[model samples]
Target: MVEIVPFGVEAWLNKREKSAKYDISQSTIASLTMHEVLNLDGNNGQEFYSMLDQQKMNYGWIEGSPEFKQEVAKLYQHVEPENVLQTNGATGANILALYSLIQPGDHVIAEYPSYQQLYDIPKSLGAKVDFWHIHEEANWYPDINELKKLIRPDTKMICLNNANNPTGTILDKQFLEQVVE
Candidate 1:
């Protein structure tokens, strides 16, 4: 039986706030107010409003604006503007990528205690999900030998978080290169 995952951390905090005066469960910093946001980089909201007024804002760019795609492409080596496809956010990108790649009966290895979507969604979609654990004793890094053992010829994808969420354990450059090999 497939177990439904509950609403994520924010939903838990919302319920907690209703019952308790102090909210200590939140992982992220307090959100900034509109007034505080408008003053960013000495911007007085006028520049933002002027830009908004200049656009039709009807669905905007389907494949993201050429300028926006060009700027995002510049962040990667040997990438061009045509290579970048913008989404609403991380969730949209993750869903799109996973749904496109993962099929029923495919085998996927996902890192444990990373983002839930990394594994949970694939499992829910009928793929066999094996967890590649980050050992707490070893400072939250996955054992490379264990990873090597987990791989089979049929393994379709290995999902990882470079820097784990909540735990904030990062896979360093040398370790990442080894994984690539």
Candidate 2:
């Protein structure tokens, strides 16, 4: 039987909590408390809380509200409101994208040292996963020539982390063009 693995950062964070005083492992910035976050609007937080207080205490939308989706769709070109999907978080988005695109026996190449969910989800779905390793000596970027060598006719998807999670390494325009070629 096949089994999925725990998220790398989450697992490491759980273990690190027992001993580490400062966590530098994850990419996310320090979280803001609700009060601190709400106060950022400069209205003493009443307007936002009042809106929430008046909202019905029920599921707002199953596949996101039309208005919410519309607002999201406005940010993109040629995308309709119905095409926008609201997910719980990054993990949810990753899972949804992977599940929708991958099938058993499909091939996937995921850039290494990213948030593991990129590759792990596809692996859990039974896709053959190959790592496009980033070279530390070359500043944590994947070599385009190496990527060309790894591609197979069965390759269904290629995953990349824009500004990679922990190291913040970005794939530049020239490198991206080379990959496209």
Candidate 3:
């Protein structure tokens, strides 16, 4: 029985997302109407609407279409299309990855002021979660020395938003390479 704490940001948004006016707190793009979406879609972007070519859309491939996987693989340098997994979305992908890799009593370190789901999910799964706090004085970067201190022989995982979500500050390639080593 997982005793998950109520997600604060989600709860706050659910209570006011529809009713609030001048809601500037939103980090993601505001919802757009179908009409606006249609206008936004370009000449070849009828694909966005899945302009049906009378193709029977069954469950399709278990790992998504080969073409789709290939296209996704193109975005990465060394990744193969076969290695590219097509999940429902970011949250679903996160859920799958965390559930697959995390276990009860495992030690996990996640960035502070990140999407709560990253840390909260691990906690709910019985992981000992630690906050790797980011500082505004350092442009929201977490010191590598601090991270080294957090690491232990028993540490199971270190979760990061990659491109610090909510704040939108990116962890450059060099910084990530240093973390890897």
Best by TM-score: 2
Worst-scoring 10-residue span by lDDT in model 2: 21-30
- Clash numbers, per candidate: 0, 0, 0
Please give the range of 10 consecutive residues that has the lowest summed lDDT in model 1: 1-10
Better of 1 and 3 by lDDT: 3
lDDT score of residue 101 within candidate 1 = 94
| Per-residue alpha-carbon lDDT of candidate 2 for residues 1-181, written as tens digits (9 for 90 to 100) | 5679987678777878659987777666788999898998799788899888989989679999899999999999999999999998777898888989999999999999787889888898899999999999999998888899899999999999888876799999888778777
Per-model TM-score on C-alpha atoms: 0.87, 0.89, 0.87
Flag clash pairs in model 1. none
lDDT of each: 0.84, 0.88, 0.86
For candidate 1, write residues 1-181 as lDDT tens digits: 5554664765676667678877666445788999887777486888877887898858778989999999999999999999999998877898899989988899999988778888988887789989898999999999989889989888999999767865789899998887877
Residue-level lDDT for 132 in candidate 1: 90
Report the CA-based lDDT of candidate 2 relative to the real structure: 0.88
| Backbone clashes counted, model 1 | 0
lDDT of residue 109 for candidate 1: 93
